[model samples]
Target chain A: MWLDILDRGYRPGTKLLFALIRLLSGQPLPDAAKVVFYRPDFYGTRAKEFTHEAMRGPSAWSVGDRELMAAYVSQVNECAFCVGAHTATARQACHDASRVAAVLTDLDSAPIEEPLRATLRMLGRLTREGKAGAEDMRQVLAAGASPEQVKDALAVCAAFNVTNRLADAFGFERLTPQGYEAGARHLLKRGYR
Target chain B: MTGGHLPPVANKTEGIVPDEDDKQAAFRALADRVLNGEGQASARQRAGAFRNHGLAPPLAALIGKVADRPAQVTREDLAAARASGCTEDQLFELVICAAVGHSARLYEAGLSALAEATGEGSPGHVA
Candidate 1:
């Protein structure tokens, strides 16, 4: 389900940067990346800035935890492109990639701390149901998560909930395994901005 | 955690960025324009589109489908929107507006839940 928007140089500045990135990497930019480049001045810039702040900005949650939370939300939403890209990023940041994968496949049995698991369950509810109530937050807090960590984790979940819908609705180009790895590396190094 | 109370949802905006208030105001302004401002889509059409999560008639059906089941969106869906007279840019704007609305609701939900848990205020009447 991909939008038919032309994925080429449109804006002068974005076009130049895309060209340079393609030339250096020897690979085309992913549709997810190109989609935002469409209106860099409008919502695109804001979306990117907010994503950076949510995913890579300073927080009690580790980058890995945030990435994993994003991947988990994508998984629940069934956005394959985001699930692949963010899962790769999560794997890179976490001590154990398999654990992340396990959680994705089955959260109940995954080898994760209780607080993070509780938070992830909260995210799942948020994504599927569009709301997680006070009881959910209380459970997470009782599991030992700090309020700051819960807020940061929810921000990641909320940001991805937006991105996942955009990617799916627009029909983002699905990256290959190699492309996913490369994309993950780029995000890890440069961050969302 | 003694004396702890859930902070207001509006206050959490600061945690997202240093200038979150400005950013949020800008986003809300854009959203208002997109959803409520004049455009090619008629006022009725825009309201129905926002409510139904698509434009009108057959197109609204498709938009509703996409809103409900995003993964089911395909080239056919895009082509249908185009055939219904939606330009690429309009389609892009619609998607952003719908998504931003969804995100806002989620943020409010989390904040409300947290506020309730801390016994600070009721979910909707947070203060």
Candidate 2:
């Protein structure tokens, strides 16, 4: 990690909790978890709340769809850790790992529905260029996404945009496939909170 | 007000209905908290990161890179900012601000796009 303090700067209680989590899980807590725990009140608490609602709240988008959006945004931002973490979660949630891989590899030839493909296009533009024009939104709508769906997708985009940046800035370590699977299971069970 | 019509008409009614969606409400609260709430960093520092302006050289550079191209951020960036005397907690808060600020901009753009697509808040659009 770029920041040594963030790597090992937990309070005593948090440290004990981390130890317990590691012992039970058979793997150290991911650096993402560690960064959030480092300062719950400062930004982590609110970030977690927003993420939970965005990922698990009542929305037209499915859990798998949202996870895939996150992974796609991470991919655009070049955050390997989040791409791995959310790609695993997307696979688990959707139960279509190959399709997920296909979508990541090439959105055009990936066989996803037009609506999702269009939404991903918008998200990619927003992530890479930091803005999407009205025409971009119109494309998604033309592809059969509702206005509400656009909002939902934007929420997912916002959350991952924040996470991808932090993950890269902190230099979060990429996990093994097994590690990502385990973490995905945990995330699916517990949600982002 | 005088000259109000001379100014560009504000898209004052633009934006999603915040109270209607629990998720959007929570996101608004989180944005407010991250940019305005109490934290280890000074309010000015947080605001600077949020607006992507008015920062010291090292912090400005770090936040700009983190928000625009995080993949390019290196250990030296953080080290340079640290050398400028920010504690780890403060740096953490600043980074969050930059990230959230950028995300918020994107969110706003998406909302505006949606509004335009739906004619929800466009001036002179008939219901």
Candidate 3:
């Protein structure tokens, strides 16, 4: 990470907690998690709550779908760490590694429903341009997404749009594939809390 | 129709919708907490980060990078901002503000687009 504080400036309690986690897990915690723990009172508390709700709250989109959107947004922003972490999580949540891979590789040709494809398209445009037009929303709606689904998808987009930038700004260290899979397992079990 | 040259109703409601979902509400709260809530960075710095303008040279350049192109942000940017006499905590808060503000802009645009597409609001209100 870019900040030394984030790397080693955890409060004593947090440090002890991190040590226990490392002892049990046999690996250091991911930097993304570390960022949240570094300053929970400042902004991490709300950020964690918002991200958890966005990814796990009541919504039309499945957990896998939301994870896929997170990965896609991260990809658009060129945040490799987020892409790896979320792609693994998406694969685990959806139980279809090939499908996740296909979507990431070539979304247009990916084997997915039209509704999801349309939503991802809209999200991609918004992430890249930092704005989307009414016509874009119309396409998603016309693709069979209810208004609520659009709202849900935008929630995911908004969350990752914040996270991807944070990952890059803090320079989150990229984990190994195994590390990503482990983190993915934790996310599946814990749901970003 | 009776009022002379009244602004569009959509313009009056160009931001977050009144009835937001749980996720939307949470997202808004997160952004609000970072941009408007108490933190190490001054209110001026936080607002400047959100607006992507109006700050001293070091922080201004750093916020611009985080808001527009975070992938391009380097350790040097953080160092320079810190060198401007702001602590690491303040720099971190400003960076969070920039990222959250960028997302808030897109989030609002998205909600407005959905409103316009559904004919619930008018077009040409977004910048």
- The best candidate by DockQ is 3
In order of lDDT, best first, we have 2, 3, 1
The lowest-lDDT stretch of 10 consecutive residues in candidate 1 chain A is A1-10
Q: Give the TM-score of candidate 1.
A: 0.84
**Model 3 misses residue A182 by how many Å?**
0.9
lDDT of 2 at A159: 91
Model 3: which residue pairs collide? none
Better of 2 and 3 by DockQ: 3
Q: Model 1: iRMSD?
A: 2.9
Predicted candidate 1 versus true structure: per-residue lDDT over B4-116, tens digit per residue: 12222222233332223333343434445545554555555544544455356557655665455667777777778878888876777666655665666676577567656
What is the alpha-carbon interface RMSD for each candidate? 2.9, 1.1, 0.9
lDDT of each: 0.72, 0.83, 0.83
How do the predictions measure up, each by TM-score? 0.84, 0.91, 0.92
lDDT of 2: 0.83
- lDDT score, candidate 1: 0.72
- lDDT per residue (tens digit) for residues A1-193 in model 1: 3555546537678778888988888777888788777765545666777788878887878889889999999999899999999999999989678988899989999999998899999999988887788899999999989876777777787678778878877878898888898899899999988
Candidate 2, clashing residue pairs? none
**DockQ class, candidate 1:** acceptable
